[model samples]
Target: MKFKALWITETAEGKFERSIIERSIDDLPAGEVLIRVKYSSLNYKDALSATGNKGITKKFPHTPGIDAAGVVELSRSEHFGTGDEVIVTGYDLGMNTSGGYGQFIRVPASWVVKKPEAFTLKECMTIGTAGFTAATALHKMELLGQNPEQGPIVVTGSTGGVGSLAVAILSTAGYEVIAVSGKQNAWEYLQHLGASRMENREWVNDQSGKALLKPQWSGAIDTVGGNTLVTLLKGCKLEGAVACTGLVGSPKLEGTVYPFILNGVSLIGVGSAEMPMSTKLKIWDKLSGQWNCREKMNAIAKEVSLEELKNTYIDTILKGNVMGRIVVNVEA
Candidate 1:
């Protein structure tokens, strides 16, 4: 069957081109389930893939969207059947696989989760992979005994997708949240998402060359890696856990072990894409129930069509200009 999709290709000059075009359902990779996608979400990784970032996607002529929510049209696994509403995020969906940029996606049944009772397909995409990563960080931190009562939690990159959701989720879970952002103009938006206050990036990006600094927060959800990750560890309180979620700043970690040995600080790595299905379900359940931040979701979401993704957002995101999650209406 013919379907609409955003397609990316690399030219002989090594430049990548993006366009919306028609695709065939038969062109999809072999999988146990076929979903008619109603919605997908834009992520930084998707922007990288769309721009021919070889690290994110190895092939050209690809569809780039890592998070998808829709209804199952076919299924081979006993876990799902036709007409089942489902969500698929992470696990190679947008990398080497034809992904959610298309109106349809066929993926392994194992990669699919039945849509939570509280979320419509659009709402699911609103939370998307960004929120999933944030939730995973919270899950791991709490597993290590970190709690809101420990003290205020800091969310770095507070205006971006994961950071924005992290602030909301942490606050919804009863933590006092301090949002860190370089954008001085986002204070009101941050406050609306439950952040108690805001800090400039310099507040967390210490450059004093000290091995450690005074503890500013009880714990943290850091999306900006490299020196920012180091700063978080150096300044974290005893038993404080830092969930390292992204490397947008840089992939390098140049720091000492003093935080782990002398301060009892723990660094939790959140790799949501490859997390076990049981854990994925657990996080999704929390997001839909106890951790549901419906108001925050509404405030943080901006819907766009496939053409807009190609004409605008894909480039805008790479430039770090987007404020919140951009949910895509694939059928629009």
Candidate 2:
């Protein structure tokens, strides 16, 4: 059967032109399972790949979407079967393989997880990679001995998908959350997502190159790296930890080791793309049940059809003007 997909073809000038193309299972990359994708979600990495970032995607005429959820149409492994609902994220789905920006996807069964009972296909995509990353960061921080009694936890890029979900989960777990963002218009929205207070992006930026700043936050989930991460490293309380993810700002970190040595601060790097399947399933279960925040998820997600995604990808995400998550209904 043939299905529709948003294909990115390279022009002679090396730019990409997106168009809906008819594709069949034969066109999909070889895999152990074939999934009829119901929904997919956007991420920064997807934006980069769609724009022909060689570091992310080496080949053109590729589909770009990092996360997807749907029912299995065919399977070659005992772990999954036809008609089973499942989700696929990370592990090369959108990088070097045909990804979720289509009505269907073929992926190795090892990369698939049974969809949690708490969420439908749409809801699962609403959470997608962003929510999973947030949950994983929180879990890592807790494992590293972070607790609510310590003090307020700060979340940078609070308006973005990962940061927004981090605020909701932390607050729902009885922790005080301070949401930091550069978007002045999103302060109220962040508060609605359970942030106890809203802070400007400046709070996480130390322009003086201070080796150590006064301890402010008990812990932090930093989605904006670069100067923001440097500031977070310096301001973390004694024995505190910060989960560093995303290089939206800059990949370089120019900071001293005084925070780690003097304050015993630990920086945990979060990579949701290449985690083990067991860990991914565990986090997905938590997000579907105990850590679930329906209100906040709805607040941060804007549902759009696949047709609308062209402009969304080119304008909102590529230009850094997007806020929250954009869930794509592939069959819409």
Candidate 3:
């Protein structure tokens, strides 16, 4: 049967266009499972792909959604059966392969996870890759022995999808969250997400030549790397850990190791794309259960139809004007 999908096609002159196209199951890449996608969420990477960013995607005429939640329509693996609720994120969902922007997706069984009982398929996509990444960063910090008693935990880029969710999750987990963002309008929103305090981007960007600063924060989840990360390193409490995820600011890390050797600060790298399946499952369960912030999650997400995704990508994420997650209802 043919299904509707938002397909990206490239002209011979290299221009890209997005339109609703009809596709069949046979059009999908070979995989052990086929999913009828219920919902998908937009991410920075998806915007990159939609705009022909070679770093995130090498091919045109491709769907560009990195995260999806839906039900199994077909399965070749014994691990999952037809009609089972499931989620698939990362692992080439939107890069070179067809992604969740479509009404259907075929992926390797290993790339699929059973939707946690605490969440519906729509709710799972509401959390999506961004929320999952935030949770993963917090989980790593907790594993490194980070606690609320040490000092306030800072969240940079605090109004974006991952940053906002990180603030909510950390606050819910009993940590005092200090949100840092340049979007002045987001202060109230961040406060609603449970941030104890807010810092303008300028405040966090202030640089001192000193290798280490006052060691103010006990721990942090940094989504904007580069100079912001450097500043964060200088201010981290002794023996504190900071999980670095995105490069929205800059990818280069330029600073002294005094924070590491002298203050014993730890820099943890969080990558959700290639994480082990077992680890993904654990994090998903936590997000669905204890760490789940339905109110905050709902507050940070906007629902849109697949047809609206193109304009949303160009006008919002690509321009960095987005405030929270954009959840796409493929069938809407």
Candidate 4:
């Protein structure tokens, strides 16, 4: 059956064009399950794919949504059956394969997870891939023995999806959170999301030539790379860890190994793109339970239709002006 979708194509001149178009499940790439998507979400990676970034999407006329939550319309795998609520994130769903911008999606069973009972289809999109990444980062930190007693945890890119969720989960779990963001107006919003305090983006920038600075945060969840990651490493407490993700600032890092050798600060690279289903399910369980941030997730997310998604969020997020997550209702 034909369904509504947001289609992106490349012009002969090699530019990208986007619009709402009609699609069909039969046209989607072959997989083990067919999902009638209820909700999708706009993410930085989606914006990149929509804008014709080959790194995120190589082919033209693609559907770009990294996060999808819906019900299984058809399932060939014994692990999943028809009429089940499910979610698909990362694992090439929206990268090289057809993704969630369409009303229906067909993906590998390995790319699917049973929607946590605590979250509805909409709330799952609310947490989406961004929240999942944050949870993975925190989980790694906790596994490494990083705790509140060491010192406060700093969340860079604090107003964006991953950073915001990091603040919420960390604070909810009794950790002191220092939200560092450039959006001054979001200070109050960050506080409501459980940030114990707030700092301007300046905290992530350091120009001093010192090999290491005074230890401040016990650990850090860094969403911006480049100098920000370097700064976080330089100021991390002894034996503390930094969960590094996102390169909105830049991909380059030019810092000495002083923090690693002397302070024992370990750099933990967190990437959801290629995570295993076993680890993904474990994190989703926590997100549906104690690590879940319903209030913050709902408050921080803006709901938009597939049409509104293209008309708005793509540019806002690409320019780094996004305040929080953008939820897209594919059914709308």
Candidate 5:
């Protein structure tokens, strides 16, 4: 079958070009399930791949979308059958593998999750990888005994995809949220997402030479790494956990081990890209049930056509100007 897809090609002169192109089912890489993707979502990693980031996509021509929600069109695995609604996120998708920017995606059965009845395909794309990451961070934190009663949870980079979802999900799970953002106009948006309060980026960008600072929040979900991560660890309450999910600020983590030793604070790395299927199912269950924040997520999400994604939203997200999730209508 012929289908439309976003195509990225690198020029010999060393620049990347993007276009909408036609593809065939025969062109897809080998996999156990073939899905007719109805919706996908834009993410930082997708932006990187589309712009010729070798670390993301080593090949010249590729499709870049880390999240896809659709119906099975073909299946080689007994675990999934044709017509099953499903989701594909992380793993090697949108990186070394062809991803959801296409109208169809063929992926390993193990990388596919049957869509929860509670979420529609579009709704599944709305949550996408960003929501999954945020929810997983909270899941891990809870597993480590972090709780709402311990104190409010702080979320950094609060206007971005992951941060926005983190704020909404944590609040839905009964925690008071302190959102931190560099954007001056984000307070109202953050408040709408259920943040009890908002703080400037400086609040969590401490530069003090001290090993630890006064305990601020009970725990944190940090999307900005480097000094911001250090600040989160330094200011967390005793036995509190800090879930690290991004490196938007910087990848380097330069801080003393004092927080871990003295306060028993824990730093949890949330690597959703390669997250286990079992854990993915557990997190997705909570997102669609007890942690259902569809109203807030819907409010934060805006749909875009594949054309619009390549022409506009990708660059917008790279510039750090996007306020929330941008769900891609692959069928559009």
Candidate 6:
């Protein structure tokens, strides 16, 4: 079948260029199942991969989408059959391998999860990798004894994809959520996601050189790494937990172990990509069931087409200009 896909090509001069081109089933790598991608989502990693970032994607002439949801077009594994709904995210997808920007994807059976009955394909993509990462962090923190009554849970980068979903899901679970963002213009939007309060970006960039500052938050979900992550660690209450995921700020962590030794603060690292399937399933079940924020997520999501992605969001998202989740209708 003829289908459309975004291809990022590294020119002979080592510059990168993008194109939406036609692909066939033969072009997809061999796997046990074939999915007709109904929806995919734009993510920071996708943006990085599109720009010829060797760390995120060592190869070019590649399709970049870390998240995809659709129906099974074919299956060799007993785990899935044609027309079965499925979700594909993470696990080397859109990295060295062909990804979901194309209308169809063939992947290993273990890499594909049966989409929960309650979650539609579009809704799955709406939440995408960002939502999955947020859910994973919270799941780990809950296991570490995090609770709403401890104190307000602060979410840094609260207007970005993972940050926004973290705010909504944490709020839905009854935590008093304090959203921190540099986009002062989007305070109303953060509140709409159920953040009880707002804090400017400056709130998480403390540099007083104190080994441990006064504990303010009981817990935090940190998407912006670097000094902000360091600040959150310093301010967390005794037994407080902070889930660290993105490195939009910086990957290098330069802080004392004082928070852990003195305050009993737990820093949890979250990695959704290449996340074990067992853990991934648990997070997905919650995202599709009780913590299901499809209605709330739909409100924050802006749909875009494959054709619109390269021209519009590829550059903007890299510059941190996105508002909330950007869901891509690959079928469009």
**Residue 252 CA displacement from its true place in model 2, Å:** 0.6
lDDT of 4 by residue, 182-279 (tens): 89798788989999899988887988977899999889999999999999999999999999988999899899999999999999989987877788
Task: Tell me each candidate's TM-score.
Answer: 0.99, 0.98, 0.97, 0.98, 0.99, 0.98
The collision pairs in model 4 are none
- Tens digits of lDDT, candidate 5, 1-332: 89999999988899999999999989999999999999999988899999998988899799889999999999999999999999999999889888999999999999999999898999898889999999999999999998889999999989999999999999999999999999998989999999999999899989778899999889999998999999999999999999999988899999999999999999999999997788889899999899999999999999999999989999999888889899999988
Candidate 5 Cα errors over 4 Å, as ranges: none
State candidate 1's TM-score. Answer: 0.99
Q: Which digits, one per residue and each the tens of the lDDT, describe model 3 over residues 268-291?
A: 999999999888988987887778
Q: In model 4, which runs have C-alpha deviations exceeding 4 angstroms?
A: none
The TM-score measured for candidate 4 stands at 0.98
Comparing candidate 1 with candidate 6, which one achieves the higher TM-score? 1
- Give the C-alpha miss distance for residue 160 in model 3, angstroms: 0.7
lDDT of 3 at 124: 83
* Clash pairs (backbone) in predicted model 1: none
* Candidate 6 structure quality by residue, lDDT tens digits, 235-274: 9999999999989999979999999999999999998888
Candidate 1, residues 4-100, lDDT tens digits: the string is 9999999999999988899999999999999999999999999999999999899888999999999999999999999999999999999999999
Backbone clashes in model 6, listed as residue pairs: none
Report the lDDT of model 4 for residue 85.
Answer: 97
Predict model 5's lDDT versus the native: 0.93
For model 4, state the Cα shift of residue 11 in Å: 0.6
Q: Which stretches of candidate 1 lie over 4 Å from their true place?
A: none
Candidate 3 achieves a global lDDT of 0.87
The local distance difference test score of each candidate is: 0.93, 0.88, 0.87, 0.90, 0.93, 0.90
